[model samples]
Target: MGFLPNSMLIMARKPGLVEAFAGLGLAVQGPSALPDEIKRMAAFMASRAAGCVYCQTHTHHQAANAGISADKLEALWDYETSDLFSEAERSALRVAQSAAQVPNAVTGADMSALKQHFSDEQIVDLVAVISLFGFLNRWNDTFATALEEEPSAHAAAHMAAHGWDAGKHAR
Candidate 1:
């Protein structure tokens, strides 16, 4: 049987809040100087760093749809030393990881490095991707949201080797 994720259903309990959250997420995912692949990758990295299974699975699925390779997704945790990522992708991933840390570990050096590779507007988009996933990661984790089937399967097939598990978010 099909099911709505608990996170969305719970948010739906407050229609206005759900609508507002969805609106803001759409805005963040809208067209930008930053490529969709980069935004998706950044979001995935943020979700992984946040340790939210539901968000991680969802972002991983989206990242694949945005043209990120299975190899890249599998190796994302090591992007800092991976040859698959470009300098710009590495910079963006670093920003995602730092920003997603608890207590907000992002530093000036992180932003400076990002600036070397991205325009100010692009940096904004990267931050927006991280911020969007940050909200989703907290919401899904708090709700123990059940993973949707597609993302669940995708994560199983592609993310398991990277230490991904459904955990409390299992469907």
Candidate 2:
């Protein structure tokens, strides 16, 4: 977050991919009915389920920037039983987790649960957040994108407690 990420720096070799993602990133991350914090949470969960340490750290930084509490982030992977999350948050996170699976594990019951808490537009936005991270997770992990300082430090301080490490993405 402090400087250009290695992924973007490398992606620039093919400028068209960067241009395409610029618009898509804005569209997916831009303001909507969905709160930034929840979007960040979904992204963190998606990136984690995808095993992208680079994105996991980035989303951790963004989640903190968006005011997600350490308590919630600490309990993220265990949200199903975490008191820090409400049923609504749990539903969205469930979708993110399921959607991150290779075979796309989302079920009818998952959609129904999401519908109970989010409007149609919000659901789309939530899916978009998860979908966006799907792309980002693959990009960073595939490239072994080096961790940026701010996020790397943050992940070290806050995220390592949850068993995160830079691993192959280490700077």
Candidate 3:
């Protein structure tokens, strides 16, 4: 809602590419069975697993804005055992964590676990959230995109204790 993030700004230079990605972004983020909070949380964790400081800051900021509590966000790394999370949330976050790995660690058992909590369509949307961040993580990390003040501050406030920082993305 503020100024476009640096990734979008860079994408803006290629108008068609930006527009295309925006359209896809809208689709991935559009109305679905999954709530925005869950999707944003998956994105935050995906960005974290991908080790993209830029995306991590941005997604964590978004998750917070979507009403994800500070304590839950802090406990995301341990979602499997965190009392703050539901079984459905744990399954989805597990997918985010594994799917973001370099070799993609998502397993059939993981899918089975997710099926217990999510509909096929909902799973698609959930995976889309993770997939979108997969691309974003690579894009931002490759560019060493400058961390913006708002998201950087948000991450510092909420995620610094989790070993998160501006890192290579520092402006």
Candidate 4:
């Protein structure tokens, strides 16, 4: 048997659910204090480490739109050995990987890198983005939510049509 009945699933797909997703989208997109590329990179690294295919796809396209190269994206699979990443990207990935594996595994080196590269405010937002996606990864994994479509496309269209900070949108 599946996790939930079809009727309940349908109810979960109602307008209120859509609104909640919209809120999350806005929250992720509303980090005006941080560069959009860095935020997307952080989210992508966290999602990759968490093994959330949905988020991986979403953040991959988001990275692409933010001017990340395909080679760099592919190198994310083995970021440690790849030359495609910058010091900042590598540092953030270290944080995400350590956070994913063991909470305190993010060491002094990681902290130093973060401090060197990102502002305090940006670090706060970065951590929040990581934490949020960690939660999302678990939730989506638990529910076995099939990532059938790329959310980045949806987000792009929404931003293009309405603007980046638009009030409401879909998942």
Per-model TM values vs. the true structure = 0.94, 0.96, 0.97, 0.69
Which stretches of candidate 1 lie above 4 Å from their native place? 1-6
* Better structure of 1 and 3 per TM-score: 3
Order candidates by TM-score, high to low: 3, 2, 1, 4
Q: After superposition, how far is residue 79 of candidate 1 from its true place, in Å?
A: 0.5
What are the candidates' C-alpha RMSDs? 2.1, 1.0, 0.9, 9.8
Evaluated at residue 152, the lDDT of candidate 3 is: 90
The parts of candidate 4 lying over 4 Å away from their true place are: 1-21, 102-104, 149-171
Q: Rate the local accuracy (lDDT) of all candidates.
A: 0.87, 0.90, 0.89, 0.65
What is the C-alpha lDDT profile of model 1 across 16-70, one tens digit per residue? 9999988997899998999898898888889888988898888888788777787
lDDT of 4 at 34: 71
Which residue window of length 10 is worst by lDDT in model 3?
59-68
* lDDT by residue (tens digit), candidate 2, 1-171: 457878888889999999999899999999999878789999998988888899889988888877888888888979999999999999999999999989999999999999999999999999999999999999988999998888898889998877888999887
Expressed as tens digits, the lDDT of each residue in 31-144 for candidate 4 is 567777667777877876786655655666667767876667566767777887778777878887777654447888898998898888877877777887787667665565
Clashing pairs for predicted structure model 4, backbone only: none
lDDT accuracy of residue 78 in candidate 2: 93
- Cα lDDT tens digits, model 3, 43-64, are 9889889999998888878777
